[model samples]
Target: MTIKEKADEILYKTGLYEELKTYGEPHPIGSYRMDMMVYNDLDIDILNNSMTLEKLHTLTNYILKTFRPTWYEAREEVNDEGKTVWFHGFHAILMDELWNFDLWFFDRETITKAEAYCDTITTRCHQNPTLKTTITTIKKDLLTKGLYHYDKYTSMDVYHAVLTENITTTQAFLKTHPLTTY
Candidate 1:
């Protein structure tokens, strides 16, 4: 099935079925809209807070859901007017693929603008001593075991581990770090 179908199925199962709205489009068919407002809940507190693991966990899960894997690369972009706002989305290849799910996260932020968000992720995966190891381990495990690896009862398998453990790590990181607000 297609991503839109999968998303619709998820919404239906979750009982979040809502009316679809439409507006004039920049192109021919017309612009369609939906109330996929989950990203709206990502308040500024999520950025400026020093919680490391919490922020990371939140970010990863977010990207995974908002921009599920497709034939496109995931990206974090920004648009600045006197201020700046961040967007977590996929290129049109993925965008078109998941059009029904509204595959983009519009996070209107000041400090954690698109550039900063990208930089933060880069630093964690590349610069930080401990984080680099953590990310590497996760990637290796993901590659070795593929989809079901995370479900394995092993502490080393980071990605397939329990969801609550992920939450705990995220909360702990947030408690230890200071992600300054914009």
Candidate 2:
């Protein structure tokens, strides 16, 4: 099967595809366990104080335990200034070995703008056939360089860079952003 078909199958098995189609894309909040952004639509102040964070932690823990993932992992990295920062969320192999996904939860007041941005990217990709191949090549190169992560950079960023800056290859992209990890 094609990569997109494989991804769709995985999402369907994990139930995320259904949830996303029903409720839209979820907003990410960085923390111990990645919490689903379900609470974002509520009045809860996810970032206000420690109490809210604690509650979110508890909720996330409960969800994780209930899911009973095969295994989970977290990452940490040091920034340019030398302070170590843990990456915001956990990577989970949920249900089975094939179901690898990230979990992040936090509260955001609105996801309309983010969702719109996603739609724009999708539309752009559909309009520009070559754009998808360029993005895929860039992602593969970034993965080989060990810099393929949503937190590191995104396909949308790469797409915009290629369109606006005339970046034709991954090497060109790296040249443009010398400070980037890749």
Candidate 3:
């Protein structure tokens, strides 16, 4: 089976796959595709409790243990837009014979923002089928070239570059933007 299929099987066994598909949407980020699951307001309130946060961490640890992926790491990033903000998340990489699977976990606000961004892109794709086709072609090309690394660029970045900046090819996009400096 393909790595994605294997990952899906594991996720389904854990019930996370269905929960995410029900509550979230798919987002292709760099070389990996993630389900950006956003917690509802009520759920967010429930998660605000310290005990609940601890339990969530415990659950995360359990998943990491159960999956025994190649690597699992927790991450915190600080984003500033006139004000400093921090986001906490974790990602696990599962490697198979032919491919890799990355699973991401994020806080409510961050996932909500991601969901909105994905929705905008989806809207754009629906409005212009040609743009969608372009994105698919570029992604396939990048995958073939072994250039679709999460640390370097994402399909979303490619789509934005093509749709907004008139950068049509992956080479041009890579030339202009390169990987993020930091």
**In model 3, which runs have C-alpha deviations exceeding 4 angstroms?**
1-10, 17-53, 75-108, 175-182
Task: Report the C-alpha lDDT of model 2 over 1-182, residue by residue, as the tens digit.
Answer: 44344444445675644443332234322211111111111111122112234444554464366445455453444546564333223334432333334532222322344445555655666798676567667867876786655677555567677667868799888778665555
Minimal lDDT window, size 10, model 2: 36-45
- Per-model TM-score, in order, reads 0.24, 0.55, 0.58
Comparing 2 and 3 on TM-score, the stronger one: 3
- Give RMSD (Å) of candidate 1 vs. truth: 17.0
Reference-based lDDT, each prediction? 0.32, 0.46, 0.49
Q: Per-residue lDDT for 63 in model 2?
A: 37
- Return the TM-score for candidate 2, rounded to 2 decimals: 0.55
In candidate 1, what are the lDDT values of residues 12-109, reduced to their tens digit?
Answer: 45332321101111111101111111111111111221323444345446545644634333334444554222223332223233332222333324
Off by over 4 Å in 2: 1-58, 66-88, 94-109, 150-152, 180-182
Stretches > 4 Å off in candidate 1: 1-30, 34-57, 62-68, 71-78, 91-182
Candidate 3 per-residue lDDT over residues 44-162, each given as its tens digit: 11112122345446645665665554544533333553322222233444343322333334445655675566667767767877776667667666767777656655666677787
